[model samples]
Structure formats: structure tokens, C-alpha cells
Target: MIKTKCFFCKKSYTIDYSDSQYQKIKANPKAYYVCKKCNESMQREAQSTTGLDMDVIDKYDKFLR
Candidate 1:
């Protein structure tokens, strides 16, 4: 297991040695890791502030292309 701390919450946690995230972090020592809880919280906060639904943004992106 790879031991690391969450960048946002500063909580210590472990990542499985075989996980893709672990491999990425291993490749870059300066990479930051966000715990699942902080990641979900940030996603929710961002979505709430955006005011537009994800589907609408996706459709707009397709239309632009």
C-alpha cells in the first residue's frame, strides 16, 4: 500500500499498490492526492454553483464542435 495525505483535508490515507492513482503518484512525487470525501464535496460544491445542468453543458459542447 502507498501511504499519502489528502491535499484538501490533510487527512492521512492509503492507496492500494496496484491502483492506477497510486502508479501515477509514484511516477510523480510532487503530485497531489485528494481523498474521496474531499473530491466528492468539491464536485458537489462546483455543480451547485454552476447553475447549469451537466447535460446542458455536454450538449452545448457537442453543438460547438
Candidate 2:
């Protein structure tokens, strides 16, 4: 069975689709498993935000490029 548990809020849904949906989401295929509520909250935050900043090690990773 496909687990639909959103890694963010840990909310389980009736449909199990995230794992199988990784390819359809983005070019890198990095899966962010977030349930509906948390997903909506993140969406709101993203919409209100501007330039993104990489945290610590993430900054180093970008420094390589």
C-alpha cells in the first residue's frame, strides 16, 4: 500500500500518491511529503515570501556552483 502520510504534518489521507508523484512534481524529483493542511500553509508562506536563502550547509552546496 502506498503511504500518503505527509512528512510535514504527518497527516494520512485516503489516497496514497506522493511517492508515485515525485516524477510529476519537479525536475529534480526531490519529494516533499506534506499533507493538505501543511501544504496549504506552506503555499501561503511561499506566496508571501521573496528571495530564498539557503541554510548553512545548503549555502555551501550552492557555493560550489
Q: What CA root-mean-square deviation does each model show from the true structure?
A: 6.0, 9.6
Tell me model 1's lDDT, rounded to 2 decimals.
0.75
What is the TM-score of each predicted model, taking all chains together? Answer: 0.70, 0.41
Model 1 TM-score, 2 decimals: 0.70
Q: What is the C-alpha lDDT of each candidate?
A: 0.75, 0.52
Give the per-residue lDDT of model 2 (tens digit) for 1-65. 33345677677644434434444444333455565577657755864584454444265644433
Could you say which candidate leads in lDDT? Answer: 1
Best by TM-score: 1
Model 1 ranges off by over 4 Å: 17-20, 54-65
Residues 1-65, model 1: lDDT tens digits: 77888899999888987544687778885789887788768866877998766556676644432
Model 2 global lDDT (CA atoms, 0 to 1):
0.52
